[model samples]
Target: MNSHSSDKKGILRRLRRIQGQVSGLERMVEDDSYCIDVLTQISAATAALQACALALLDDHLHCCVADAVTRGGDAAREKVDEASQAIARLVRS
Candidate 1:
């Protein structure tokens, strides 16, 4: 496969793992686990999600966003705005 497809597959794998972590955290809460333990699991899940998001953002900046900028036009400006808004949302979370 091409490199883009390979990167998407890897990202999907990480997302699935994060999904499992979230499920496990739900189970922990259902089991009435200690407050600190539950919070810790939540923290871990959040970190995993953030890591995946950051990885995707890095890839976009390096490839898609870079290409858009190189093209140089309204489309490039739009892409930059879109990417900036996305990063802002991610940071807010």
Candidate 2:
């Protein structure tokens, strides 16, 4: 039911990779890996997640938002406001 249903598989794949990275980070801690090394991996994982969020946002704009705007009514304004809120959340995060 998502606008990005077409990208679901790819997004899930990336999330799985991020999950693996998190596991690796956990293992690194268990094995007493260097702090900087662990932090580096953490940073990489964070960036990957942010990239995924941005991609989803882009898809929402192109698909859901576009469709709502095409309708040209209260729904259009609502969709735009929703998008702005989403962007604000992303930026704040």
Candidate 3:
């Protein structure tokens, strides 16, 4: 029933990589790595998270929003509104 069900496995794999990046970042900080080195790792982690967000957004639009629009009526409006809010949050981040 999930919007990203088709690619759930792929998404999870990416998430796990991102999680590893974060853990590495924490280790870098704990080990007192050079400032620039820590910053580079942070950037990598941030980019990974952003990519994950975008992928999920694409899946939501193609699956959940598409289905809602096809059904028509209030469900479509709700989905559109929900998607808009999600986009806004993503952009703000």
Candidate 4:
């Protein structure tokens, strides 16, 4: 199974909820909702997305990347490099 398959349903559920929040934000803008209220929802949606991303990153480190390292040799070294690049990219973003 894929490393994230176990949490797929839960992750998808969270994504769908975030999608709904975004849709609501669109409606809020269309309806001219208060600025603070819309901003609050936007902040919440951002937090939700960030949370999902962190969870997937954690799973990748613990599963695929860890397994690659255990395999040893060049492949392990490559996986480490790949993980480091991914982390750097995430931090930069």
Candidate 5:
């Protein structure tokens, strides 16, 4: 198995930042901040979340999926199928 210690740290950091963004959004709404400002922050949070998801997907492709593909068996097909479905969902989002 591959160790993604650094990847994990980066992801956790991103999540923490996203959490702070959400809190700020909440405060903005509570304080009746300008509509466009709130909307802009929301967009920023959404983009950050999507970026984090892509990073996780990239890690999965490079590690688990790559290993399964190299094995050339049922595991490979399953991993490919799994990755395809994940990609489709992300695209739909």
Candidate 6:
């Protein structure tokens, strides 16, 4: 099973909310909203996305990485590497 299965609903809900926020941002742009206001909304949306990423990373460490460590050998090393790459991407972002 997926590591985040337990949080699937919550993650989806967060994503849906972000989607709405993006739509609202589009409308604001279309209506020529103030620059600061648009930038603020963009920041809020970015923060929400980061929050979701953090939650998923937590789940991955607790579930996927934990499981891989238990299994040992190549699987364990692969999981560790995958997690490292994920962290790197998040850091770059």
Tens-digit lDDT track of model 1 for 68-92: 8999999799889988998999989
Report how far residue 27 has shifted in candidate 5, in Å. 0.6
Candidate 6: where are CA atoms >4 Å away?
A: 1-4
By TM-score, is 4 or 5 better?
5
Please report how far candidate 5 places residue 88 from its true position, in Å: 0.8
lDDT of 6: 0.94
Q: Which parts of model 3 are misplaced by more than 4 Å? A: 1-4
Least accurate stretch of 10 residues (summed lDDT) in model 4?
Answer: 1-10
lDDT of 5 by residue, 4-85 (tens): 5339888889999999999999999999999999999999999999999899889999888888999989999999999999
Which lDDT values do the candidates have, in the order given? 0.86, 0.92, 0.90, 0.85, 0.92, 0.94
Clashes of each: 0, 0, 0, 0, 0, 0
Of candidate 5, the 10-residue stretch with the lowest lDDT total is 1-10
The candidate scoring highest on lDDT is 6
Evaluated at residue 1, the lDDT of candidate 3 is: 34
Q: Which digits, one per residue and each the tens of the lDDT, describe model 2 over residues 16-37?
A: 9999999999999999999999
Q: How displaced is residue 65 in candidate 3, in Å?
A: 0.4
Score residue 74 of candidate 2 by CA lDDT. Answer: 99
RMSD of 6: 1.5
Q: So what's the TM-score on candidate 3?
A: 0.94
State every prediction's TM-score relative to the real structure: 0.88, 0.92, 0.94, 0.85, 0.92, 0.94
Task: Give me the displacement of residue 93 in model 1, in angstroms.
Answer: 0.9
Question: Mind sharing the TM-score for model 5?
Answer: 0.92
Question: 78, model 2: CA deviation in Å?
Answer: 0.9
Model 5: how large is the Cα RMSD against the reference? 1.9
